[model samples]
Target: MTDARPLAFELPPLRAISVAIPLFILAVLLQPSVSARTSRRLRLALLVPTAVLGWISPFRWRIEPVEFAITANFRWGIFSPYFLMLAVWFGAMGESERKNELAWLGFDGKAEKKALGVEEGSTGHSTATKEDGNAGLRPRANGTLLAPKPRPVSPLASPALSLVSNSSLNDQLPTPSPSPPVDPVQPPSVVDAPPSSVNVPTLTSRKNATRSYSQRHHPLRILLDAAHLLSAMRMIGYAGGPRARDLPPAPKNDKTFFRDRLLAFYNAHLVSSACLALQVLDRDGILASYLSYILPHDAAVFVSATLARLCIGVSLWVQMKIGFNGFAILFYLLHRGTNAFLDTLQAILPRRWSEELTWRSRFDVREYPALFDNPFSKMGEGGVTKFWSARWHFLFRATFTSLGYKPTLALSKRLGVPKRVAQLLGAFVVFTLSAWMHWQALVSARYNLHPSPAGLAFAAAHSIPLTSIYPPPSTSLSFLDRNGTFVFFLLQPVAVFLESLWVALTRKRVSGWAGKVWTALWVVVLGQAVVGKSWLALGLVHGLPPLHLWSWHRFVLPTCSLAPMPVFMR
Candidate 1:
């Protein structure tokens, strides 16, 4: 591993610059003095450059294939855009939310604001401050000040409202025009604003708030909260898709540390088992051989690759679960150990000292929720939309939406595009971004592998239509190239639109068993195209580091009878 060659030509000089830019943008957002409009403009202006920098920076770093895949794919490819998306989300926040950071921190400070005579819409200038510095005031023929022009509401505000709105059950009526002027000292309540089309949690809804209410004033806590919202996988504090409705209710607050520990151990066991299974599958190409044997004798190369792609999909799903669960276990153990140490200290110290240190104590298990919902629980019940929204892991949803879907939707609305057409365009944009993200990962992984001239030639040679078997020579099958990875993701939105078309014509959704078949065909068979070649060429079949379960059994449990198996190798 130490001797492995670096993937890129040289170290990128602008990598640190790329990183600093986003942090700077975040800083601007956090600043109370910076107006929301300025922050938004700055963020929008910097997005492309930030993406370009992140994209290029990882390639400059010196690392082996495995290391590069793990480090660069996250730090640069995924997280860079993720952080930017968060910045955009923050920039797009409403004035009421911007004025009360505590609200975002999960503090229900509405009473406090009221006591301080801080009325909603009373503070904070609009985006028109720069252009119409006179507060939208223009000289009338009578020289009387005309009521400040009602600033045209932003279409982008839809998601922001969805995020901060307290209740989903509110009437879905379009916002009424401003009523006759109230007293100068008081303003209409924020509740008077139009309800968001999408249902999500309000900033004051502590139970579902993005951040924990306790210790929220602490800077470190704020940073942690920002990170939590950045990922927003479960959409715990924000608006979620239709699938969110299917999620099991949040874990009750009565959950104990012991229960959390058990949960952690359970997840750890799953991770271990997955790693072992993946190792077994990779060794001697057992999975490859199995797929080959199961495929029909007359199956074309495309058919074989498509079927094999399902295995890759399963492998990816397992890997995702492993990572999520592994992190959960680590967090649980850390909390357990910290609490144990805290208890020991409290027992040794005086009561006064312990009381003073209470705020510094470890987090309660109840503060953390389950990392994932059971995605399989309601599979195919809602069609492709539900599959991606409710059934699939939502780790990338926020990033995809903020960077892709939201902007397109907003722009489409602004352009007078029909509502349905706008939705389709927005969905397509989201998938396009997803496709680019995966393409970048695959391309980076390919570069790191440092394929030889012979291997490259062979890969190119097999790119065309040809058929032999599932487990091709050297497991570097090339019936599909790296571009297939992009194609697979790009087709997702097409599936969604097709489903919509079906509904439009048939007056019913594609659901039940029929929905299952539809999803399988798109995901397993027709959609995979050439993705298998990309993974196989990257030597990703045995991508994960194995646990060496067989070796452990042979050496540690010598009395146990087990057959010898091929060891996994890169």
Candidate 2:
């Protein structure tokens, strides 16, 4: 890595981006235009080669020598929107393509989902699906696909899932069974009046009714009361509510304009990914170094991706001014841009394309929000758990959970590790697996190329912090950071474990906001650190004022080479 210094402006190695990005976009847009089977084949055909090439390390160990298998600087060339875009391509391929991939591997696509108890259309709103030989199952709180099952005749009990009611009062009343989907929010008039023969309580007078503390003004609450009175009616009326998870397949003729996919991916992934690829573009050898960055590359992005343009602007400015490569900036921001790119494609591509990713929902954002505390500002109410699980982009959530979370639990049981120890060790394993996946990007490499410092640094950074999560952080700032890190995932079970300890010790919850604030601060601080040297490595920070005036320059005038500093001007 070169230190930031004034030098002749280099064109930088963006040549591959032109080909890689266009190829990526062309593949995605064309996906829906073809049959699902062909689409899947095309995506994997594009992805496999790109991935194999991406991990071909150019550098040889701490020695900093560039070697090559396919090209002089194979790694950088692959990274130039090549590997990144391919990953994006694989990710954006809709569910149809995904299922096709599974079929090729000889697995029935939906068979596993059925095995997992993830049946669809169980709600009365989706009763139309009952005719498909799947009837009378409800979505669990943790939405997964289900298989066909018999209706619960008792309404409260089923072979599929057991219901443990908190209140015994429910036992006295008839079981609240599935009724024709009704809008709980509908007006009381939508419900029938109680029968005259049935003994019923009524307000003695209008004044009493008006003054009653429990007056039913809200439509839904009123509907609930009506249903209780009409309990025998079974609330069996027709209505509908859309299940949030049942995303539709991609449009057969997706209308994503040719130019939009090109421009969107270029600005987001191409720009930074291309920039990052420059450092090792000319190196050779795979035995020394391989892998990507610190925090995992996210697939679950765009829950906070409104800032795509802002991140892009910052990156370009940093690049033009420094006259170095902008690769390091990719480390800080590519996930957001890639996510934004996918979001753009999804809008025009198909729903299946985006099902691979997860994001923040519009509902209960504060209490049960996605990775971001607020997407617009890129602000997060960070805590370790929140950052890792809910707040940070979940681009790789489904992937990571499958590869790391479940397998770790299974392995732990086999090894007879305690559940508590397993969880702690499992986190390390997950981070380590993240490292290995980064390595999997190599097109050609030797076995000795293991544990690149960059990946080790990433894994160890989190792993060490994790050990301190227990003992409930101390008053020291480092300890506090540790506690918060452990909770959110930067550090572990310590901060998360402290939740129980705090409640036990003080009978009150810890101030979540404090941890959030610390997490946010750490993000800002660590972000600068993570990107700083890498910028130097990528040559993006060779001392010059940033080109923040691109919009003005583009339409009004063409800016010259990177703007010089006051010292240089003097």
Candidate 3:
């Protein structure tokens, strides 16, 4: 009571407790259950709220006030290990169950059999115990005799017996003897039995049995095996298997293992994508499929990490421009490494999807490349006509066309929109998202929000030159120029837009000229959003341009840097 007056200025502990209680409760309520479906749902439901709370809580709690302290990122750090453990645990559980199932199915040598009443050599007089139930061994009529019931001869035994008989026929012969009275009391022992015509199990049957056992005990083993298999298929060249015929052939002495590693990396990427695609294909409903398998909580971790890395990297770059050394190089390297990983992934994805789709349809890998190649080949040869004739094109067109005819279709339904409109919309969306991501990057970098003169100059120079006179450079060139702000702004939007156009045109929904113009304008705005003036201006004026001039002089002019610039020019 005496200290109550002094304590009045201090916030009550209950205030913190009150805020935390609800969050804790919500987290517990939203925690994923054991069921994959339930877990997935919980994960999705928790994502936005958790992220919001994570970010907000940091500010509320002042964990990292300058940066967004969303629980999403922290959750990734805290829960990722647990999530991974869960995946492994579930995977192992699935494997063990499969093994048990296989054993139950008689693939295991210890598979349950009808039990004999007595031990192999025990007298029949001994009472059959329940404990001896499934023993295959049986007591013979003679108290001392023990034998197994003869199993049915397999079809393979005859040919093997015939081969043996033919080889040994001339070497051994036995004289015929008159039949004698059979002994009543004697026990029979199977000693030196002629290599029984009982068909020796073939290698194939043994393999089948092994597979059966594996499948039974570990149902998920097959799935995990398939996962590994798909992964292996993806890694064929990278993991020291055969090279892809479709890809450029490897050099004989290519010791760098670049091709192999690249192939493996690509394959791994495809396997992940394929896993997601499979979930998409298996699930019922449109968004459900996309959300369920495609958008697992673990995936959010990956995406968040990528985004955070990018943001951190750009922030460091900006800080470096402003003479701040903190975190710049680390961010740069992280971004580069991540990009390389993603590039490998992008390269192999289409091939993986094509293969998956083909295999799912035809149940054969041989047809996969042909299936994927046919559409592209057709497009190259027949252009729009060939595309229309392709199966996928027809399917896509028909889906939208059918949607258009539906009486319940809403005005907001994009299904019946003209192909061009759809494409434009798609392009716009992708470009906008990309721009927003870039803008976030700028913010992270502490760059000025205003558009910089250097960025504008670079864009104007590159766009006017490349779009006007030349065919767009190869993807390799684009990749090389990826570091440049203007290049990315100009190129990425255009590329996304073109991709949208291709999709729409393929579906026969080509937009009018005005729509295309509008789309182009949107790209410019999006580009501006991504490339903050403060960051771009410094790089353009002091960094990239000077480096370019230096290289050009050193190699091309041979004495250019040595020469003085005009006073006015300087």
Candidate 4:
């Protein structure tokens, strides 16, 4: 008989976990104290572990499958905080700059200016003077000189004039000073000019004012700017309450405002996602193709998945607000888990793969033919081709080209059409495609699969319209209406229309009531979502059990057993 012996296994090194724990703890501790600025820094810091663990030697070391898998998963899990930190950080940084700029533009009030270290009436000017030997000069209260000078220098040199008489002649010829000391008359109160009137030098304006204005007016630019503005407002504790005069101009048309805000929110998220793509492409070379090609192949799938995540997150928050604790936590965990997985995969992949993936995912030959390889490309091929070859197209093309990827092919060849016209057409096409895809996905998913169509439709009908009328309420409504299926249907088309209108307006294609009608639709949709039955359904769904509890228990929630109804015999 052989003696039985237990097998001994060597444990894998816990370097990744060791590194992650301290940082995780630090981030948790710092969360409450994380101002917009610090939050960004913390996010950057979190990336250190992601980068380090991703590059750790001997990642192939074998342990128990469960333990190894958990560790590998944990490495990915860290990316949630990593990407989230970066998103919040980037948002905060951009917002801080935007608020400062807006305040400089005369949109923010005294308190905001003070909080940003912006002097009232300062006009972004530096107090430091150039050393042209005019250091002591100070402008007088009434725009008059204190004393007449013997010789007048150049008008430019007048800035050097001092309040006190500095000439030796005044010191020598002071014999009459003892006669009498007249009381100095009180100087008339001089009101300073408003800062908005002061011209501040800007690189964007100086380089090319027309281009700058056009770029700033671009729908994407407007959306990013709005995101920054909203972030700044939230940071300054002015997220809610009465309208502040210093805030950036609120959307004049309710529908336009709602649509713009939604777009801006989505764009901000995309930008962060783009960053992840860039990181992944830099790491994994070929595997990133799944993200770049397969996912983006069907625009509807991409939009639906992205929007669904957002809606679910918002819905979870809403459930939490309305006292549905269990559902909220479950939703939050699922969302976080999925987000973490995606973020980690991106981080772990090679940079080349990631870039290729991003390019393939965002643009396709079918949708964006201009980006395709064409042998006989020239001027006036078609409306779409003409639009792609315009001057604005070249400018936008150049912008993306400079970023190291050519979004459109044949950008090197100059088309006869004006740049702005082409750009407007391109922008319209892009927005329309994105919006339509999103709308189709939401409608199909909600109507086909949802157990409670009436509840969802009712919620959407009210919330959509209400959000347009009152934009702030949209955010809350989204949170309360878990899954945001209703909200998505209402908002997506509005966003598409707004983008199209913005492009048309840019190209002088349409204006006035036409614009207003398009804008109004967005407002109505948003309003319906905010005040709709969806809000009510959130409470109802949480209170009730799954429609087919036995089936749900067998598959969806295996931990729970269904209660059976008793039968009555007549």
Candidate 5:
């Protein structure tokens, strides 16, 4: 890796911190006491530097052979956009609105006496009040309370998932059983303390106690809180909020937490192994020859090639799923380990920080949200709007909307545009941003390859396959073609418009069997034809290192004379 790009810019690695610094600053500035006007001013002041640093940061910072396996560094494509979007997201709204929005998004704005370990001797008593909306009240090991949290539902129980294995795409999914009514703002375990004996601390006292403790701890509180805030931002997946429409209803039984983790692991392994196997199969003209042999010789070359492109596109989708699962696993382990580490350290630390540490530890698990909804199930339901808005991974929805969609809509409305026209404008902007993000990602991934003569010569000298070292793309198509990634996303709004037009004329939504066919025709057929080939042209697959998880030519089909295992797979 070093040999491939010895003189590669050193600044790219340091510049990556540009995103984190602004986020930490925003976290600090958004604390409850900051006035709306002050927050607005501070945020406005911060936005300039944030945007500047974000724009200048290199996308080709962290690419190694290992990252190719997970495509982790591909995020560089969106890193700048995300920082810009997040900065804009914070700056666009004033303090009151921001607090309300964050509260609705399950972030507590109120200072907690228990959360800061200010309630010195009240270990056995519960401190939550009915008015304390969404106050998550879980008892600690020493019977103290943690901070307010919103209860999370199991991620794997999507109602749409019931029909995943059914051959018919149009199968109506079974309605999930409604969970026991939960308070939108408060967890059920929060038993309101009786006023007389409980001596509920006032807000001022809570703040005072927090201040005193922080003063004593000096920078520890600040550091921990910033880390906590950063982790919080990461944990707030998709920003669909707790009431996301696509989220499956919570189950009656409450034991799905461990089960959900297991499912995530299973999904990561299944999708990753499948993607690698597909990669291996697609290598060295193997899939092309196989398809040609299997299909009639009379089949048009265009048809066979289109089919191959579709296969590659499906593999791309699988690769994306692998990344999602990889992140999910990584987050779960990180949060769990952080909590355990905090617990172990708490005992050895000063007594004043014990409950504070406990608060932070529990906060890790309590606030962790599900990363993805059932995207396939979403697609099978039909309609591009449903797929994009509800079925797709929503991690970037807030970013796109804040950075593009909402602002456009607002500007259009202010300019006296019709509501529908404003909405359409917003949708287009969202898609445009989406296209740019994906295009940049592809560019970043390609840029990171930097396949040098030395690297190739080294491969050759060691009798290594050039494919393993990311040989230049064999296809004639340009890597940065606008017709590929850009067009695919850009055309989504048009498909959405067509669906809207159909609904307007027919007085019906685009759903059911017909909707399924319509969606497939647009996304699977048309989308894959352009985007899939574009990705292949960019040499995206060659970036992924082999997992060596069972070779297709070895265990799967020994009789077939397939190309030998590519490079390190053997």
Candidate 6:
């Protein structure tokens, strides 16, 4: 058995500087061209440069402990291929989302401010719209917009006096003369404000004109906007006229898109959060190690992968019974800590870099959604479109569309195939690609026992290391079989396709008691691999060492290295 280590990366300051010079030049020269051109063909051209850099990036290096062994980072240089792929994806999208894409990459844009109807800089005059009256006709102070103050009521205009048409006192009061015309360019002076002789009740249009909360200039708005941009990035395809049930309803207005108080929050946001959590799970090293402990074991033993899995299936019920791990307190802390650290990184980036990372926008806390539906919590009436697009949030939508959907759709049109066929074919390609990616990920596995049943886990570590430090496996497919991770993902498209047929036949969804039963059964059976993988990754196993959950060395004792998989950080 050969020992493999994660790729080693070191860019000495001088070498990094050398690399940065060329990258900077390329970025400046290509930014405009890439931004304007949304052609898939043009974006595909990026692959050449990316491949070249992946072959020769000076900053990155790797060494395996065993001779002939290869590292994961060796797959794609510095993850540049992934980074470039995402770049090409951003460039291929519509112009509207391009702003979002750029914002994520740390580009400054007036888009959010413009979208919310706020203009930059002082015009040295009022900037309010006619519809909003003079209430909005005020200059910003130190860049902060404030509500217009109310006019003071006069003592002479006593409580006893009634100006209403219904009051008998109305006849005794004289009507004021026509007021002087207000200058549009001239600033309104507070000292010269109209007297109570005018007897006009104060009306505030600021509340109605501006959103109750400001998204413009919000610090973390960029992150929120980045999240939206990333989610929407997956949906940027010509996949037929959108069906109502297929995707989450488009934001009703700018308010909902920006989450103004008046607009109701959409369900897709919750789905996005759920998808992100799943993504974090897979990227973290914990799941992979846990899977290794479980999957390569026999079904006969108690708390074997199967038994542990079954226990997992009933864990919520068990937790409910014990009333321990209540309210998911542990999970809540972990989520907050990780997100806080991520936000800190986002905030620390310089303006140019920040602009590249996100747009100027606020993540409206008011629009904060409660966890209800996730990618898997579907109840029918919704087809595969609804399943993947809305509920699933198509975590890899952008990648999938760029890699599979667009290419197939283009070819299908040339061959004159039906749109539905093209769509299903595209979906199949996506699933296949996903399965393949997962399969490749399985190539590198290191065994570790959970805290409890450690002896059994060690005993079950029977499979030969598919890829080790000495040399990599011949193919990622070598790790696959008829019934494994690949098959699990491959089966999704078929399930979705069949479910679509059922919806067509019945004109109803598979939800409620029936859907719940179906979901649980599917999870227990078809989804066992995924659940087991996740439980391990989450460090949820009974006897998994607490240190193993946080440290790379403990998880794979005797040695560890910086991994692209979040294991290094954990």
lDDT of 3 by residue, 67-135 (tens): 111111221222222222222222222211211111101111111111223344444433434342222
Select the stronger candidate by TM-score from 3 and 6: 6
| TM-score per model over all chains | 0.59, 0.34, 0.24, 0.23, 0.67, 0.42
Question: After superposition, which runs of candidate 2 have C-alpha atoms over 4 Å from their true positions?
Answer: 1-50, 56-131, 137-382, 429-512, 525-540, 543-570
Q: Give one digit per residue, the lDDT tens place, for model 4 in 1-570.
A: 432332222334675345444334333322212344565665556555543543332233322121212212222332333333323333333322222223212222232223223344554432323432222222223211112232545644322222112221111100000001111110001001111211111211222232333333444333333333222211211111111221133455434533544444344344433322222222222223445576554663444334323343233222222222232234334545655665666678998654322211111011111111121222122122222222011112211221112122124225554433333333333333323333332222222122133333433553422211111222354553544434544344334344444445665432345544543334333433442234322221121112221233322221111111100101
Better of 1 and 2 by lDDT: 1
| Highest-scoring model, lDDT | 5
Question: Pairs clashing in candidate 1?
Answer: none
- In order of lDDT, best first, we have 5, 1, 6, 2, 4, 3
lDDT of candidate 1 at residue 312, scale 0 to 100 = 58
Q: How many residue pairs collide in each prediction?
A: 0, 46, 27, 47, 3, 28
What would the TM-score be for candidate 1 when compared with the true structure? 0.59
All candidates' lDDT scores?
A: 0.44, 0.30, 0.27, 0.28, 0.49, 0.35
Write model 1 residue lDDT over 1-570, tens digit each, in one string: 233332222223455445555645554454333455775677566656665555555455422333223322332344434444555555455444343221222112332233223345553322223322233323223212233434456665543343333231121110001111211111001011133221112212322233333333444444444444333343433323212233434344434544654565455445434433543343334445556577644443344444455555554555455455555556656656766876788789999777533544333332334444544455566666666655666566545655566577669878999766766777777777666666565455334443334333432453411121111333354435645767777677788778777877888876788788877677666544456445544444332323333444422221111111122111
Estimate the TM-score for candidate 3: 0.24
Task: Report per-prediction Cα RMSD to one decimal.
Answer: 13.0, 21.6, 27.1, 25.1, 12.8, 19.5
Please state the error at residue 246 of candidate 6 in Å.
Answer: 9.9
Q: What's the lDDT of the predicted structure labeled candidate 5?
A: 0.49
Write one digit per residue (lDDT tens) for candidate 6, span 1-570: 432333233323343223333333333222222334443345445545543453344224332211121222222222333344455444344432232112221011122223225566646344445553433423334332223443465755522122111221111111001112221111101001121121121111132133322323243442333333333322221111111233344345433533422122222223322322332333333344555675643322322344444444343222222211222233334446656765676799876665443422223221222212254556342433344444443335446655576687769979999765666676677767655544433232212211123222322352212121112222322333322556666666676566556666887766666665654554456656664444333233222212223353423321122222223434
lDDT of 3: 0.27
User: Per-residue alpha-carbon lDDT of model 2 for 468-507, expressed as tens digits?
Assistant: 1111112322432322222223333344444434445766
